[model samples]
Target chain A: MIKPWLRIALAGNANVGKSVIFNQLTSLNQIVGNWPGKTVERAEGTLFFKGYTIRIIDLPGIYSLSTFSMDEIVSRDYIAVEKPDIIINVVDASALERNLYFTLQLLELGASIVIDLNQIDFAAKKGIRIDVEKLSEALGVPVVPTVAITGSGINELLSTVITVTSGERKLKPLKVRYGKEIEKRVQAIEKLISTKLPQLCTVYPARWVAIKLLERDTDVAGKLKNYKNGKEILDYAEKLATELEKIHGEPSPVVIASERYGLANKIAKEVTAIEAPPRISLEQKLDAITTHKILGYPILTVAVVSMFALIFVGGNFLSAGLEFLFENLSMFIEWGLSTFLPRIVVDLINNGILAGVVAGITIALPYIVPFYIILALLEDSGYLPRAAFLMDNLMHKIGLHGKAFIPLMLGYGCSVPAALAAG
Target chain B: MQSGSRGSSKRRNPRGIKGVISLISLREGEKGVMAYAVGGFGLVRRLAEMGLTPSVEVKLLRKGPFHGPVQIEVRGVGLALGYDVASKVFVRPLKAKLDD
Candidate 1:
């Protein structure tokens, strides 16, 4: 008997090791594609573990469910509409408060979530200690602390997923409850949505829809406008939001965002304790010099020059080695196959396909490999952002922002990924 | 386009205007409490979602060398805001030393 495929999604903020976890679970079994009609890349991979085939989708990393960008909209729609069986929320343990702000939104969306507290070691180094059990209890979901790079706690995470999805263990995620002012309006809109447009409830939780409407989310508003009663609900939502604006003296979206942040801050404080006041670490020291007003420019120049210099030298050595090895292999193949096959066939097999492949690898792989490894190192080590910070002023003069420098720099190595990243 | 010195020097009556200065005006190591961000709904909402709500304390960690982005600490998170965006986020300095 074949077990049904278990669907899981890895969701999180940018740079929280979600991709690392995705790569860990899926290993070589992965396919990269685009989300239909959207330029956003979608990665799907499968893992077979413990008599189960699990399909994992890595959603685009985004900060909130708000439709600020195409990524946020795609993630939110996938969670609410597609409805994955389990969502592995990879949150940075070092930055729990800000990360939890996104978690709160996920909970609000009513997704079945397991919090992957990634980079726990980084948090520990910063003298931050988290009560994992307390956090699990607070969120009312299983919390797995993991260091994705080292593969620690990954097995336990899988086991937890099995236990939760297999019906042995149950998840009772905590519902986010806003303050009195916002909660009352949320309930009012939720009630109106349930009564007026019950069909919308089938696709989304009434409460979630109500909250989105209150936030003046254009996506939901557009969807609502299609329904006959949606106009009435939209008007009511606008009036209620205006009332909230009157009370808060800010836009409804800002009001709701502030309230959500307040709750995230509260939960983060409750579950985490700082063992020591922040002392300057080596990263901080490096950050200081690398981003210094006067020294930063010269250092950035040196760093860029050294990177290219290393890549060129390393690629040349590797290409020469591979070329030598492949030359002998091609000769052997030609000689070995000539005895059994025609000269033309041997030539086709050896010189045509094999030589072509060998040439491509020797020419392309050597350079691409070193360039990517160095790029990954720069990104993972958090130096790339600083480099961008240092180049911001210079980059702005060329009609671009600081972040534009990354793809521009990537252009020196390869135009394909650089163009994709620039988009 | 007000520089730090120029912005601070143009003193307004404390009772009338209250000393809420643009976030970029705070030099490195200076601390301020976030007032409200002034921008279109998109910008304000985006900043608020990143935990830059009113009353949260922010410290100017560093500024890009030449009128670039401003790196600030808000709610225990460090965020880099562009010059134009940073200028819209008004904050009240914790200490009133600009006058002295």
Candidate 2:
């Protein structure tokens, strides 16, 4: 059977194993960084599955579809504009309420999606039990429980994806409705958009554009600027927003956000039950010490010092080992070539091209590989946030947040991911 | 006590309801319910997107030393907010009634 190429974007909150799932599905060497916003840009990989080619896009972790951050804008534009065939809404099951907040926003955009309920093991450990069938019914989307790191439930996730894409499984997504007050204005703006700006409606769901207008999203507002009667719609949106502000006594955006959170909280409460009392795990205990007011700084100092020291000692050892191997290989190659070619030619080939390649591998890979491994370990173990929590105030002295330390430390190993992190 | 700290009335209790204080004012381990953020629309939306919307329970899990960011737990998620950002998110502390 012939199948057309399908594009699926994996999106959710930061550090919720989207990249891990991306790696699982596409077998791509995506940096599975632990920190939020680690995947600054969208990473794409293709998988040939059961005769169908699927394009998987791993979007940066975002809390909401709001245009406050670069990651949000990139992910939002890609989903709304590019219109991927299926969006894998990867929710961290451990933090269902918070993760669902983003999931709700994606639903509002009217994109076809399946909830990759990633990190179910973590939730179970935390004593949180989710009714998967109920959650799927509530959201009106297929919910697949997955442990991306262990490659569990990944095959089921793919089969479900193919079924949904093939139209074998029909989805009736529940529309995200807000409070009556907000809903009234949303309908008014949505009608105005559909009738006046039909072209914009094609690009974005009319209702989504209307809701964004109600939130006074500058990005959505900017998109409307190109169309005729755009100014009139903006004025109408602004006027309605002011009226909403009057009733809520807060900004329009906040009011809309509160409503979205309200919905997310409701769904989370409905589908999740506490099966067991949460026990303080070793991870929490470690977090306590590493982020302790007094002890944290000392631990951080030792961690930082030891990381660099290991890199130095390990890199040197590996470098020497590789250099020795290359030296022997170079001698063998030169001897074999000199028997046939001129001595000068053999020397040039051995000393120039081969030597350059060997030197790069021996010097760079030895240091870079160790640095990345240690960095990944620090991130994967969830120690980086604790380190950031400790350094927050001191980092303020330099006019950067404590989170800035991650990129600064990353700069030592390589400047590229560090620069991306900083951005 | 409130008189000395009074500045922009708009930034003050946005709803004119008393007994709310900045989230940063809570000591480590203290709990509060989110009230409202006082900064621009961007900050309020950003905080809410992180699940810090009004009426949600929050606990100050840790405070960085030397006037740094405050780590707060909301909706079972831990978030570190810089001093400037945390100060704008006013919350009604659970201890306020006891103190009063």
Candidate 3:
């Protein structure tokens, strides 16, 4: 009997430890690069489990499926076109409401999903006890609580994936219900699309297409224009959207997004019991200070400067030791070659091969590896977002968000290391 | 720009959120429940995705001294909404009965 292949995608919001879970599952041989012409990075890796080869892709971290950003576009296209066997939404248990908002979108897409509730320990510390079974039942999917850093609940997540993919377990993901005003329009557009343009559903969920139409998502809206009856669908969508706007006293997308959040919040409140007031922890206090208006700038400057100083100082020391060791190694190789070969061969050994290897090992690797580690450490400790939060106003002035700061700074150094560190 | 939208009709006049006051009116550390994110669809979606839904309580964490962008805490996450974006959202003060 031949083993079948299973394709999985790790989807989540940023800082939910999606990358950590990806690293734990795939381990090595991961290919990392940008999504052709786009600056945002793409990561893919492969592994074998239970005699089945599994290909895992770490999609870009995005807050929503709306095409407001490149990350959202790339992720949605992949899910719609490629259609992976299972999508694992690695959510921060502590931030259920926000994380669940994204999960609600995935469910709307009708994806075969397994929820990996990462960072459950932190949530527990916050006096949040999530009833895993109840959450699973509510979302109508398997819910696996995991501390990705510790590799807990990973096996259960894997097994659940197999069951869901192999048809042993059936999943009926909960679909979010928008209020009557929006729902009525969704039904009308859904009917039009099905009757006139059924092929659209082949690419995207029919109702999802209607919702996107109502929300005036440019990417989806632009694509629909090319199809027959697309004009009618768009016009109807626009009219319905306008009515929705008037009814809610907001835009159509806002109404849709709020409805989604309403569902997420309701679900979160139901499945989790807050045993204590989620008070500000020490980390939260420090996080606040790091982004404080009066003190944040100085702290940010000192933190970045200190980080680079440590990297330079530590890299210098490591490089010095490595340089000393490799120099002797190259000398020994040259001597060994000189005893048996001509001068030219010894020169080649000394200047050509040994030089290249020594330069890479003793110089580049020493600095790049440690610097990348420290940068990742800062990012993982949740400092980057805080720094971004503090510098948001400044970045906003430049027509960018605070999240752009890290990438902008990374460009000053080698772009490769920056991509490795940030991507 | 005035925080409230000119196009959309008000569903219900919020009692908690000042009737006409926008998010800019809130002081630091003042917490209130969101009434509406009044703006274009794109802008509203951006804020809603950050958990700034109607009736959801939020805290004004900080803002730069020079009338800069504001940082807010919503759904246990801290975010910095630009001045333009911040002003578009309206909020009512959190009431004791709506603590949940």
Using Cα atoms, each model's DockQ against the true complex is 0.74, 0.70, 0.44
Error in Å for residue A398 of model 3: 7.4
By lDDT, the best candidate is: 1
The segments of candidate 1 whose C-alpha lies over 4 angstroms from its true place after superposition are A311-377, A403-423, B6-17, B96-100
- For model 2, which pairs clash? none
Q: Which candidate is the best by DockQ?
A: 1
- Please say which candidate is ahead in lDDT: 2 or 3: 2
lDDT of 1 by residue, A176-274 (tens): 999899999999999999999999899899999999999999999999999999999999999999999999988899999988888898899999999
The CA-based lDDT of model 1 is what? 0.88
Candidate 3 per-residue lDDT, tens place, A102-192, comes to 9999988878899999999988998989999999999999999999989998888898899999999999888778888889999999899
Residue A171 Cα positional deviation in candidate 1, in Å, after optimal superposition: 2.5
What's the TM-score of every candidate structure? 0.87, 0.85, 0.81
TM-score of 3: 0.81
Q: What TM-scores result for chain A when each predicted structure is judged separately against the true chain A?
A: 0.85, 0.84, 0.82
Of candidates 3 and 1, the better by DockQ: 1
RMSD of each: 4.3, 4.8, 5.2
Per residue, candidate 2 scores C-alpha lDDT tens digits across B11-84 of 46656678887776677788999888877767777887788888889998876777667789998888888877
Q: Candidate 2, which segments miss by more than 4 Å at Cα?
A: A29-40, A315-369, A399-423, B1-16, B96-100
After superposing candidate 3, which stretches have Cα over 4 Å from the reference? A34-40, A278-280, A293-377, A384-423, B1-18, B38-40, B64-69, B95-100
Candidate 2 per-residue C-alpha lDDT over A1-423 given as tens digits, one digit per residue, 9 for 90 to 100: 578999889999888998789999988634433224444655778888888888888888888898887888888888998999999999999999999888889999998999999999989999999999999999999999999999999999999999999999989998999999999999999999899989888889999999999999999999899988899999999999999999988888888888888888899999999987877788889888988879988999899889878876898999999999999999999888989999889978899988999988987788778877887898878898778877877887899877788778768866755676687
